[model samples]
Target chain A: MKRYLKICMAAMIISGLLLSGCGKKEKQDPDSTSQSGVMKVGMVSDLGGVMDQSFNESAWEGLLRAQNELGIKIGYLESNNNSDYGPNLESLTDAGNSLIWSIGFMMGDAALEAAKANPEQKYGIVDMAYGNNTPPNLISVLFKSEQASFLVGYIAGRMTKTNKVGFIGGIKGFIIDSFDYGFHAGVNYANADVKILRQYVESFSDAAKGKSIANQMYQQGADIVFHASGPVGDGVIEAAKEKSKWAIGVDKDQNSLAPDNVLTSAIKRVDNAIFNIVSDLQKGKFAGGATVVYGLKEGGVDIAPSSDKHVPKEILSEVAELKTKIIRKEIVIPYNAKTYEKFYIAKQ
Target chain B: MSIKAKLTNWSNSAKRYLDNTFVFTLIAIFIGLITGAIILAFAGFNPFESYWAMAVGIFSKPKYIIYTIIKATPIIITGYSVAFAFRTGLFNIGAEGQFIVGGIVAALAGYFLHLPPVIHAMVAFALAVGAAAAWGAAAGYLKARFGVHEVISTIMLNWIALYLSNYLVMSPAVKRAESEATHKILATARIDLFGVWKVSEQGMAWRMENRFFHDLLKPDINIGIIVAILLGVMIFLILKKTTLGYELRAVGFNKDAAENGGINVNRSFMSSMAIAGGLAGAAGALQVLGVSLECVNLSNMEGYGFDGIAVALIGGNTPAGCFLSGLLFGALKYGGGKLQSMMGAPREIISIVIGTILFFTAMPKLIRYFTSRINQKREEK
Candidate 1:
């Protein structure tokens, strides 16, 4: 009996060893390697990574498309924690990527550090680029999202049923505030008497705070609200939909998300910028040494017209004429509160 | 002698098996339930729906699963690095910094040195490991030579390592002057995505290994998985068979008793630390060689080292246990991102869940007591 027990235990141990050996080579998708010729594109996911449908996903979609079309290799490292950022970035770079990209503004410091250390290799930073001292080989692709945001705000002001217009902003920062300022401008242009209700969540990704803020705005008689938040804006839309109030979206074409409630979205077109960078790299026309801003003329920023459902056709036609006027330098859209105050003569 | 031996043997085997099946699962579930509730409550999204969303989001697609494994790779490697140290009773809690050391050193080597693929990759790993091991050993030496507490020493070393890596990146020579990350690691040193798919280029010959699983698994997940498995087998072999493993355990269980058994406690502590540090250093090397051929920006907070503590704790500080725990934790991180998108769960929820798990982990005695009481009631019924 004892001998039998020994035999059984030995068998169990042997099987464990065998299975482990098998698991090592079993290759659970990432565990195996296949060499190829295409320039490998690796991404170190920022605070949110690929799953962040708003920012990181935009970049990821572009890279994944590049992988499929160019037959290039693509991989991404998810930053599990803040410290994982460096290692995750290193992991993708080590994996034979000629270009490594980190998605989001938070990646600026890490990207700046890594890109500077490796001069021969090209790098890209999204959102905020180093305006203080630029790198020669690194591409700092920025967007004048405020320009498009201004146009959307004009639309919201025109469309609001109530005289009180609201701006639910995600934090009080230059990039985010641009959205608020532009929306406020649109509302003011549509009606000088439009009462503006503005408040910030102090967070980019907090939907609860966004909902609460939007609810408060609705309670304050804001029949129409515009949000310049990231994924957190989804909550603003949800609150609007629930209250049957109108809302505007920022970053990408989120107008369709709440077709009945969302009047329009100021498109940042992050995906367009990402695709441009990849395409530029492929064509060897990749420009560096300066900040690359994508504005209206460059097709980097605009309002999503096609996605709008409740927006009147005449209003859309008017927006187009207004867009042309702005593009031709006939009507300059003001973004900063100081600038808006200068044009409209508001006290606060 | 026979009866006494039989009783001891039966209880030992039963206890070992019972611990494996019982301890982690019950505690893990309790933590999961609590974490699940938080997701539903905070985000106003239903918890069950969010969890299902996470599960479906990750497991439903082939590409997503591959991504999940790729995500799990570094965690497993870092977990191994920490667990190796735990075995030696050193608790080299500096794996995060070591992971960064591997990355930056490898990036420097990759960007500067031009060499054959094998050589470039090997050198990067070597340098990273060397840096991490040196860092870990310094802490060990301070403790051994000066009787400094390792817990305090390793923590201090972690901070020093963090600043040093960040300072290097911020430096003009090493920093990506225009960007946030270091310049790309040299071409030869990078882990290839095509290599992950096993597809050859238009002109080049199929260079090396058969890698039949390339189509089955992704490539960037390569070397780390191998390291993790090898570590598990090595730990098992060493613990069950080797003199060093026995001595380390003796000291871990009771230092005075281990000394009475004629083991050199100081040497054991020092050597264990050295081995642990070496493993962490090796992890750093892998971070550069096996994944991204670049250095992590140290200025920003990264958690490989800190998480290593949690991984070791959750895995019960066993090599095999850490392997499983790391995989789960890695999956949790990967899935947490999905919960945010699909179910609107907050990114912070993942930390809450892990923290909750760690909380329950501290109460093993409570779990044992609860389970025994339940068993007694069942028997009476």
Candidate 2:
């Protein structure tokens, strides 16, 4: 039994060594290297997968844009669990990708270590700035989704036929709080008499809870609703469809998902920002020393034109004017829908 | 051979592979692959092509291999941490907290210490392990002294550990003030070795100049792998051979019976938690000393603690089994990444696969179908 056990152990060790050995040999092949249009881009998604339809989807869309326009060989590893973060980033670096993108705040540390280990590789981190002060190969893509949410609130305030509007948010972190505040700030700016309801699901994945909250909003006379609940917003759309109510969308142009109910969407433009950064890298214009804030001015955030057949023409024209004002430095839309609306709280 | 000896030989050789966790893990991989393929195919992508692409991406590159092993290190340690608790009849969900606390402590040590790389790394790692073990002992004491349910206490401890870690980073103990994180650890505490991506000009120059690190081994794998594997062997030998190991196993098998037999079950319980926490803390320390290079963030849970439960279960709560399971999980994660990127497989495929394996593994009758089939094969042979 002892001899047999020894042989079994030896076999496993040999196989493990051989498997890892073979894996390493393949990574060293020169055919994988590239420059310019041949440059490769890699991403490590947060806990969510690429089709998360929020941050990951938008990021992948940006990479897809690079793949299409610049002919970059793009790849991404979705992190199913938290422990995989470091390894996922390392694999991308080891694969010799010139640039790697990591979404969400969690990847900040992992991305930093990977960048330190691979100084020649450029990295872009979303949601938060990554790395200590020294690494020159990192870029932070910070978005003022607050700005877009603020503008969308204006549209929601002006377009509400029932005098009541609602906002559904995912997670109550400072970031989401910013989204809430900016949204209410826009709505309050647009209409004083309008009623607004708010609820947070405390999760990015609970679409059912999103729908339930939207249902409550719809029942309480909210005609227009906006959701910044990541994939959970899919539930908001479902609730709208179930009740035949109006909804606003955010992150990506989610209007198409619920065309009958969606009035307009606050576009986060993550795809555009990602593509822009990658394109700059390809053109040797990659800026590493600062945070790039993509707001209304850079066309990094905008409302996707309401393609729905139901949007009132007057509301659309009014939103266009609001957009112009927002872009022209004429309007600095306040963030925080909750607090901004306190003096002018709108409810049934 | 005599009939009795031949029968025993036949059973011994045949029982080995079926009893091994890695073989089951491989079976799980195929099971996961098939399920993933079906779901993916239903979603309009070619399962075969996707799996092939994942294979090419993960295995076709040397970095993927190094990265996978790097990932395997923590899993192995956490697995032993969890498996140790189970062996003493305690369910420890607090490994996550212990890991986080240890990580934060190691991060601090990494930043302040000014020593040689090996010694600096060792001191920082030791502090982390001590913190984790101390934390675990709290729950053990509560359970052993007052008869509190370890399950409930450990669960609560996990939350305490999380909030405590969050506080550490937010407070001056670890806070960088203007920066959310503390300053980067001094260079001595970092794992300076590089396998494929060397940041140091001297390291690269040394490699190019004399092929030093390369002449012996790849840098990315690290010395931690050896520590993890050694622990696996040690755990196996100690549990099978030592008197203390026997007492612990006896307590695990039947606490009341062991207590009646003159073994102090309560003492064993407390010791078990301390040891478990130490292992998890060690895992966290190794990350700073081996991979993270002295950086630890305020993560709610590093996911290793949760996955450690899966490793313990997959390994059937044995040390060697946990090690093998850890490696298996590492492979799944490594391959899963390459799979997602190249084959367009959803990243959630890894979870789906693990979930499926867990579901089946939980049902012995369900497993019996396969093991029985293997037995039939042996009979025919």
Candidate 3:
């Protein structure tokens, strides 16, 4: 009985502390307090969260820049799972954000649904192209990621000493398919004799599987590996570091993660695309119901600036030449298996 | 003297009430909130305002409440799955695998079979549950016959299930064109609430007349919550009243003693796992029919099963306890996003609070020790 009394007192004290801590503030809706007339931009991150240091992080960097330059009130919500996509979009909508950005192709359906539901709410999504069925209030932002992958693949083909290179992907969707086929085309163009080992981790976030696959590829005499698998690329870099091999990073300049082992990164300028969209909206030039494709010609994709540290000057010059060729429509990079077959036949 | 006596009587009764499991959970929750407050203060945010923002985020809109319930629905069922197994002395770590298996089967059934509305959903649910039950029973068989530790086998099975589900989702028959996910389930298989009415013009006109209902029904509001709650009650009753439950509990308590008492311990083990798997599979099926409507090609485990372990632990492995705890977790998750949007607080703050709560809940002995130490000091005084 005495013990129970002691427990009761402890419970009372804790509850008292909690109540007292909250009692000082009146119940105020945070949404109600936002000042009107200032355009607020809200972003909903995919399951990768903002700190993923890959695709999502690049998009966030764009938002941060807009916050600094455009003088717009900016905020973002991180989604923990697929279930959070709808509610996160809804919350951003309820907050009266003038424009909402859904970062990642995974949120394409959710963004479209939310835009249809709230006709007045303007939305922009990255990496998803809804050609004909796009809602009137939503803008689709796409990147020719294959252009950058081909450049990195050319570097890997030129630099490999063991005559073997590898390509690791996250999933087999059309988006990732582009990365795969372009890499194959670039490798074949650079050195037709070099064997290209290909595999998919099937997840954008599984670093362990990525590392193991990279290790196996390295053991099988592949000297350079290129990965487009989001955080899974982190594992590929780690494995490269352990084996003293080389890894080509994706989406961002990932040289900082492994300075010595990273050959280069296939840079997809998600940050630039996002900033461009926000600035366009700010300047009253918002284009909705349109698919905006960013390619090498538009400066949306390129090999990393850090390529000079590992890639030879001659190879870098050759990559530059290829980039110009692609931009000038002199060379058409294949983005899928069928296109790759046609391109391969034409090149032969 | 009369007033003093009355106060003492009231204090004694209050002490008795505080000795309950519910009160203990409340105390842990308060401690968690306090920890979160400290973290918020350190991070340069006003803790009070941040928590208030979270509360408003959840309760300010009817749609938020519906979202919370939707998030809670699967975890609650999964919690019951884990709780049921724990009560029967089995640690069902493969609830994740069972869940994926269930989702895969349900997606196949929902898309391939063209039945009438109610009947289609029922068939999908049945197939999902049965498939998952078989998946769980395989682990049980390995344990019962080969003397394998369930923990090891279930962990391996989890990987198998993940790969298998991914393969199935990507297969031509199920795969949606140019998409990573499978085709969406047929309309007949969907269990969404007011499915036809919500989309129809007449229903829109009616909703316009009723604004509150219009806002409330905006989410994928479905019968998942109702089904979860009914299963919780049913599970509680089965454990308390059924002979099968008695046999399972007896085996869990002492296998040798139960064997001597004419119980088939091996059979009990298999039965417990099958039931647990069925519950988890039902969670997956409901999630497919009521929420996602398609099976996604997973890159990694979705983690509902692992979260169930925490839910069961916090709920003290009881059906009623699981329901309440699952709701608490769901509210925290849905509400935590507001902290990021409104307060600019890192989402990790919410994770820290939940971790602290789970840590405290796991150490009931330490709490009791502190209480006893305080009582000892009082006696000395």
Number of the top-ranking candidate, with DockQ as the measure: 3
DockQ of each: 0.05, 0.15, 0.39
True contacts kept of 3: 0.43
Report lDDT (CA) for all predictions: 0.68, 0.74, 0.86
Predict model 1's lDDT versus the native. Answer: 0.68
- Sort candidate 2 into its docking category: incorrect
Please, what are the lDDT tens digits per residue for candidate 3 over residues A1-348?
445557557877875777666755554434345554577898999988998888789988998899999888888899876767888899888877888999988898789877766777899999998889898899999889889988888888888889999999987788898899889988888899999999988677678989999999999999999998888898999999999999999999999999999999999999999999899898998899999999999888999999899888999999989998999999999999999999999999
Regions of candidate 3 where Cα sits further than 4 Å from its true position: A1-36, A157-164, A188-197, A212-222, A330-332, A337-348, B1-11, B89-91, B137-160, B170-180, B194-214, B249-262, B362-381
Arranged by DockQ, best first: 3, 2, 1
Deviation (Å) of B183 in candidate 1: 2.4
**Candidate 3 residue lDDT tens string, B3-22:** 87987687667656656778
Per-residue lDDT of A137 in model 3: 94
| Model 3, position B247: C-alpha lDDT score | 91
RMSD of 3: 3.7
Can you write out model 1's per-residue Cα lDDT over A21-59, one digit (the tens) per residue?
554543442323333346667676765557664667777
Report the alpha-carbon TM-score of model 3 versus the true structure. 0.88
Which 10 consecutive positions of candidate 2 chain B have the poorest summed lDDT?
B211-220
The parts of candidate 1 lying over 4 Å away from their true place are A1-348, B1-27, B34-42, B191-219, B370-381
Better of 2 and 3 by DockQ: 3
Give the range where candidate 1 chain A is weakest over 10 consecutive residues by summed lDDT. Answer: A26-35
Error of 2 at B60 (Å): 5.0
